[model samples]
Target: MAQIAFILLCHKDPEAIISQARQLTAAGDYMAIHFDARANPADFQRIQDALNDNPNVTFAKKRIKCGWGEWSLVQASLNAVEAALDAFPRATHFYMLSGDCMAIKSAEYAHALLDGEDVDYIESFDFFESDWIKTGFKEERLIYRHYLNERKHKKLFYASFRLQERLGLKRDIPSDIQVMIGSQWWCLRRRTVEWVMDFCRERKDVMRFFRSTWIPDETFFQTIVRHVVPDTEICTSTLTFLMFTDYGMPVTFYNDHYDLLLSQDFLFARKISPEATELKQRLGELYAAKGIEFQISNEGRSLFRFLTSRGRNGVRFAPRFWEAESSLGRERELLIVVAKKWHVAKRLASKIQEVTNIQAIEYLFDEASCPMPDLGGIQTQMGKRARHRRALMRMLYEYYDTDRMVICMDPKNMEMFQDFFTDRSITRLLEVESVFTDDYLAGHAIRVGLAGENTPSQSMERLLPTIRADVLGESDRIRDAGFERYYRISELRDAQDNAFALSQFLTIPQDEALQIAQTNHLFDD
Candidate 1:
């Protein structure tokens, strides 16, 4: 029988963890939970009380006070793995999951996927050769030793690191074992798990070295598995799904994003904030129902491959020397150009660029290509357009090397703006009345091969009413919400407030912008 022992390392939100544990073990799969010693004792007791009755759940006895970028986290995980082996002797597989992660699939699905495979399923690659680390000391993580926890003692730790760099200090990564790095999420066969424990007991020298290395939990099991297991039995991917920003911060999931996450291929998702009550409860309910089968498709897996690959800006964007004040979006200003017609959106973007200090993109979501700043260009995959557009939006907000950007998107595909409401300081919405014009017709002419005034193909005709509704209804709501970026071409043209509209983001003065728009008939559609 293929049984899985889900090892969850939990710290906070006892209620959320309790829900997750019960839901995951509802079908007789085992769970070994490790609560961080730093978490509230009452909360831990509450979890124990809730789960004490279940024969399927066991708590790790060796509670470590886990801190970020420290050896304690790995120690905590090791303790949980030991507890799982002791309690669920029949469990043939072990899964390592974060405290905040939710199991999106039934326990039976995991057993099915790993039915007969003797594999160590984790991501592992050469540290020096790989460009996966966006903002971190790559080879320096291994070549140097660190004592101070980077998160806990930021200033002292960096000072120590700098002192070492000045001294040309180098530490030997234990003999002949290739330096490897990867995500901490992993699942392993019982035999491989046992082998890892045995190695930990025998290899005290290597273990000592890792204790002094920064964030070794990320590499400890991943690196050890590559050396211990045969290449044929190793898969460089994880069962869990999580995405990070360019500054190496994991994106937290909220209520709105749960649906998007479930559509992906991963078995589990992480960084579900304790504040996300709705998202947590909904996932619990969905998984708890009987006969629910969440299938992992080839298409979702393909998308995952593309995202994790080097082509997604690699570490090429983040130089090891430059430090981040914050993630890119927080400091940057964004103006969204929303119009139903592509040509109209493009013209507005051009006008905005000419007057303002924003790097304006012609078409964000179009049939042909959306030229990304650094990423040569992107071909819009209309099939999975929603997820595709969101992913691109996230990337641009995090990594696009500019303080400002103007994205031109049609109302039908107005994807990026709302998703990043919190990430940006200046989020502007520019809605055009979307009056049909000969220029719009001329652009469509190339596509539909229509004669004069062909009233936009049947699909566009059907979509127009919905677009009009959204545009007409959203203006008052946006204005009431105190969003100054709420710009409309009709308002600017009718009231001659083009200068006032351009004032906030102006590279040129308001009078000059007004004159330019008037001279070029820029506001006339």
Candidate 2:
């Protein structure tokens, strides 16, 4: 068996780190950990105590105070690698990991995989080629110097940096080394580690240059490997699964991601935070099912106990109303009215009821809005529009148990009521609109179309095809007729008289014009 040295740069979640260490420890595999100097002393000691009996596990003597986007992370990684190499001279492979990361595959499996492969597994791309650099603030990270830890004089530093940029005073990277950036996590061979260490030692200027740069850890290893190793010898995969939110923060995995994790062929996964105790429990169960032993620390167990207790008592607990049983019976069908004003919603709801004889609920977007029942004092930390829409959808699901067709539209576009109900039943209406102009129509249309298809007792895959065809056909017609610009009815309200004005713009028939006029009537009054 090939000896693999695992160098872990850990900060938070000591219990998780210890658990990972235990999992990676084996006869030929050695684990070297470098806990951040900023970590709690108690937590560090707990990890030490847990792994004291394991001879394969060791710790870096010179711990560094690692920070995000700082050079210290690179330094800590070097320290851990040096410690591992010194402790395990016969080791053939080196794997770098973080505290938040855990192995998805067994140590034996990992050894076998590495033994069969000759190339290094490191995700890398040319700095200039990546879209992130193109779309994101390029100069701030690449050209200008960022003093991430210099909090007290940050404003002064930023001002000076901007001044320098304006004056065209920019630092240049060493000509010999081309810039490459990638995920910090990587697996390499023993020869590669020696080569990197030697390169760093020989080129102090390169190290100095990277020290002043942002997120050096992401670039330092990648740049060196790309310069030294041939492209054929480098596999462009980190073999670790990491998920991030739209805002770029790492997403903590939960029970919801259980099947997703199983489906992936990654060796390790990251960012299973303390709040994800349930996820950890589920992972343990999954591993057990695969005939692999997984364990959680006492600290993790205690934290989960406290959280579950609080949840049971309804303290800081927000129930997903969408997943709950509906108090409204099957006899009563819901009418969701999406409007900006209460008066408009009320008028539209009354008008719809008069025309179709269906009882409806009005959901107003602006000032005169009424709160949904059973959701008092529950706060969602999402953006205003997303929170409101989520709450509305939850209420709709709770009240209507059946997987029936739903129609979503704006109260402002109440004129569409005649054309909308002319074909569909009144009970199928889910009146809602997007505050965002771009997704207003398409988002609601898809939501209503998918509403009852996923009900507990239904397996109608055919419904989605029909719904999709209808939506796509309408979209194509609007695009072909040059009415795509008028899709956002609210924006059109300011320029046009009524929905019929759209008919004039597109030069459609009178019946369609009348239909548009009816939907655009709220703005007319």
Candidate 3:
């Protein structure tokens, strides 16, 4: 099994770093921490002194006044790497981490997974084709020299950048090497690490070029790994789960995110907020515990990526219908509550799951919550609404980690999306006929052009069978006349009926389904 060594690049929160270092190295694994030069001297010394008793912990040789998108970060990392090589001779892998990061999974589990694998977990991609360097100089960022600190001296940096552009000054990359870029977090094997280190040291000319390249920390190792390690040995992905906003800012985890963070498949989660003391403590206890088994999953990662894609605007994605639905829904089963008025469906939406254990969710077509489409395009408005509705169902499908989901939708929406509800392979429809007397006025206001007075849709004594339709088979023959493919709220009045519907559609046992439904108070309300 490979022994994991951690390289932590931190600028603040010494106490947090000390805590993480101790937990990570508790198993005799090693850690090399690089503190920024500008950090409080007492903070840096505190971390060093705290880890001093541990033979496996070492600090970088020198501190660097690091700046965003600069080479100092890479140099500080190199110093730590050198210290680690000297201090922990037995470590077989080196993982790059940040100050706010914590172990979501135990170090032992990571070792077990990497036991028989010789692959390097580093995300590398063709610089130009990858299109990952968002909102910055494109390919020119690599080939152009950058000496100004963008974060520290914004005006000077921009002035220099503009001057360079005006003068058309560009540096030349060695033709033999292919430029690549990726996330800075990487877990490279001992051999790969040494090879990269040697290549970095020997390639003075290329090293000099990287020193002047913007954000060298992100591209330097990526380019080196691609050239030194064969493609077969490299896994183009990182071991850390670092979520980012649509604008590419890291998502800071809070105390409430404790369960969600650990449920991920990644060994580590980057950029944990220092203020999330409870989350850190929980993670520490989990990490310090021995022999805990965790199932590896890609869906957890995919699900989170799908979840975080949401922001102030809407669920971010290309303006395409198929991409919208599939990205949100994946292959999960659906339970849509189809009604004529929004309020009726939404009110019963909450109770459907309570009374039946069906995973009923709120409106899929949330007109109020979603933003209006850009001006002057009716098609855009219609298309955006449809995509939002379908995507919501798809997202719920994955979020609950089940194949099937139930949602409250409007009949107008169902008619608008006949293509979606008609898909027999993935959908299960449900209808709500009755509303609580107190809510009667609520649904009445959201009226459809029905009976002249348009009185309350239903009364306390009224119960209705599910809507029906004639389904046809081959030769245009009606296999079953007046046959509908949906369940009704009245039919699921008891546990037995609820269990049957949930069990049949969810593929779980009727009894177990009833237990889940009962636990959620599917009928108690």
Candidate 4:
């Protein structure tokens, strides 16, 4: 049977770790615990007892304290991996997951996933940006000082090492190699695991390099494997949710976003936060009602699927909503744009005005609120923000209310303002209605071409030119204002309007578009 090995670096969160172990064990996956060296023996004993008699559970080596900029953490994780491989020699694929990562896919599906692919699961790490290299340190004192100054004391003990600053070693640092970030957790085939272990065991220089590096957990296995197997299939993104709240921090899954993990694909979700127990229970109910399950495929591969749900089939777009207007019916209007101080929203607004002949007002919220908490004084904050939103939303509707055709760049603050406006007439802006991500306005447009409802007979391709023009026009002004470069707005616009265009932009197919849109909530549910 294919198996997932849940590994945990123990700390203050014993309850969290044990709970996760229980969940994974219940789901018929293997569990392994590597208690941090600093943890009291009593605590480890408690963990052992909690995980007792679980056929899949294994207590691995005691872990040494590891610092952020050091390699000890990597060594500890590698130890757990070694133990898991030895204990479950029969498991075809070895899954390395964290105690924090709940299992969301069924055991059968996870097994199937392991059985399906022929390649090693992790991605190439050598292409990461060079900036990540600066994080590694070798000296205990310098490492301590850096962490102390950075207020990251929790990671101090394990990382600080005497060999970090060896000058000869510094000369040996590979310039061609780049550091990449990944889940401290991942899965791999048995052969790949054995290969990685053997490679590390034989390379003395590689062992030396691991001693002084920062975030060695990220680079150790990933970089080592890249040298031998140049084309492994790394799970650089989530297999489930796009984003999730973990311990109150928002983790997103996007360009190089590997932190937002999923517990499973079909039935369960990782606990968003320890505080969200109620929410998690509610989520479980939601999953049960949906009839998702894991089973062996006809090909005898373990795979998870949903019986109640089928994928969607269209281009889905998410738009940012406008902020709420305090002066919904106010007569006098203001059109102040708000954004980061350096964002240059004012210049963009000016260019839009130049093209459309509409006057724009600009405000720097950062400057307005400066000396902010530092200056204890009058409280006009709420009033100031409300004033800006009310003024801008009011002006946005002015042309619409009067039946005038016009376009204006929202003050950067209004970047999220599209969803809040209530007027149905305001929905005519094809861009806003189709692409908003805010909760204020009517939810995302579901302009499916139902036979009876208003549907476009012209394929999404036919409408692409107009959409491209509008987006390109807007982005040009934004770029002229000194914003960073991206794909030409024309390219992005077509990707946004037509599903087929999006498939081209992403280089995926039409069927994939529906899957992406549904999974990402890019279209209305």
lDDT of each: 0.70, 0.60, 0.67, 0.45
TM-score, structure 4 vs. true? 0.49
lDDT of 4: 0.45
Ranking by lDDT: 1, 3, 2, 4
Q: How would you encode candidate 1's per-residue C-alpha lDDT over 1-525 as one tens digit per residue?
A: 688899999898888788888887886688999999998999999999999999999999889999888889899999999999999999988999877898766555656778856677899988778886767687777777888888889999999989999999988888968767888999999999998899899999889988888888888888888878888999899988887654557867888655455655677888787788888888776654556554332233232333344233212333222122223355666677666566656776776667554678766565446655553233335444434454455466556557677887655432234444544356777666545444544444334322123222442343345434444444444445454557665523543565566554344576766754454544444
TM-score of each: 0.59, 0.56, 0.63, 0.49
| For model 1, the run of ten residues with the poorest summed lDDT | 318-327
| Candidate 1 accuracy as TM-score | 0.59
lDDT of 3 by residue, 1-525 (tens): 678889989988887888888888887678998999988999988887888998888888878888888999899988899888888889999999998888888767878868867899988999878978778677767766789898788899888878888898877788888889999999998898899889987999889888998888889899999999999999998989887766778888888766556556688888788888889998987766788865332233433453453232222334455632443333556666655445555555554465456666566364545333233333145455564545544444555656756665654332333445444436666544333343443333223211112222341112111111100111012111222455544323665765566555446666766664444433322
The 10 consecutive residues of candidate 4 with the worst lDDT sum are: 299-308
How many times do residue backbones clash in model 4?
34
Query: Between the candidate structures 1 and 3, which one is better when assessed by TM-score?
Result: 3
Error of 3 at 50 (Å): 1.9
For model 3, what is the error of residue 449's alpha carbon versus the real structure, in angstroms, after optimal superposition? 38
* TM-score top scorer: 3
What TM-score would candidate 3 get against the native? 0.63
